[model samples]
Target: MATDPIEQFQISNWIPIEIGGLDFSFSNASAFMVVTAVSASAFLYLTTSSRGLVPGRLQSISEMTYEFIASMLREAAGSKGMRFFPLVFSLFVFILVANLLGVFPYFFTVTSHIIVTFALALLVVGTVIIYGFYKHGFGFLKLFVPEGVPGALVPLVVAIEIVSFLSRPVSLSVRLFANMLAGHITLKVFAGFVTTLSAFGLAGAAGAVLPLAMTIAITALEVLVAFLQAYVFAVLTCMYLNDAVNPSH
Candidate 1:
């Protein structure tokens, strides 16, 4: 199992802890999550702390990210959506940083796990449901009942909408988890091919060329997937929050 492609994802406890019979051990996954959060926070803080008149590269990147999320939220949920800007921006940065960090060798991809992604998905859904009811009261239920549905078909449409709404967390979590898991597994398998073949001497080294190229190509693709997944998660979040802000249809 030492060289298994899936072995890279195995969690190892660095500091095992048991509290009231509950396992709360600090494992590799937890450590990487902490690292991701700190790295992202520190980068944004340091880069923009200067408030430069003429922006540097890091500062420019930070500002672009801010504007990107701002524009996305505004477009999806309108001016009212700006209220959730801090939450949306934080989630976007956190997931983006975590995904990118996982692209490096020996880094753990926390987003690859269903549990982590599901928890994040739940948070967004929870916020939507809570805010929807709080802001609009019973009017939030209007989200499930389309405006133009015939009276007889309203029941069927409402049932379908309810099912779809309930499935958001499932779909959101699986999309990120599956993408990260599959990409990493494919990359690892090709990488292992490169290593195993190189050990077989000159003939095998020459034969390893294809797998080596594939490994590189997949690595580049994974980097793009990392960014894309984060953006997708963030944009979907904006749309969901829009339902809470304007639950008309």
Candidate 2:
């Protein structure tokens, strides 16, 4: 009867399917992920379909997004890393759209799940590892060893670096997942308070005012956060790619 904030996060099976004991059913989360990807793709295509001398509003926004990610990769990873523009851009768009979509009622937040975020993080790390070894061969190991460390402390520093490097995916995934999860949960709690307080008479209506205001403010903040988290993810990915490109640092 009462609203449960946590209920929103529960994954429910939409179209069940099982083969070879594997549960690969389509779910609300999966549907939303598809929607996010399709929506982003459609937006880009529609916005850029007509190449006008003077850009329209949608075209301007699309070009701005492209330039923004391009600038970020150039700053973090240099021009050589521009080859990864597609990967980084798609990632940023997907996360950004998914996050913003989740802010709407009845939309599932895919990034809030550890599995989804971890997969994305692992993809970035995996690309770094694969490309690093492919490009630099044994030199990739140098990423774990700094140049200025004392000879005596080299082993300790390398050990620390190794731990830190291995923890990248975990940290990256958890950062996105935790932020989305906490933000949505806090929002739901405040929103629930507004709903609960509305049942009272005049006093109840007055009580709902503060929580309603807080919810509105948090919604605005969450919109900013959606873009920020996506940008942060893209920047970090570029930085990691830079290491793979030049392991000497």
lDDT of 2 by residue, 1-249 (tens): 347888888899999989999999999998999999999999999999998789999999999999999999998888888888899999999999999999997789989999999999999999999999999999999999999888999999999999999999999999999989999998999999999999888899899999999999999988988988998899899999999888998
lDDT of 1 by residue, 1-249 (tens): 645989888999999999999989999999999999999989999999999999999999999999999999999999998999999999999899989999998899999999999999999999999999999999999999999888999999999999999999999999999999999999999999988998999999999999999999999999999999999999999999999999995
- The lDDT leader among the candidates is 1
- What TM-score goes with each of the models? 0.98, 0.98
Candidates in order have lDDT scores of 0.95, 0.93
Off by over 4 Å in 2: none
Scored against the true structure, residue 145 in model 2 reaches a CA lDDT of 92
lDDT measured at residue 137 in model 2 versus the true structure, 0 to 100: 98
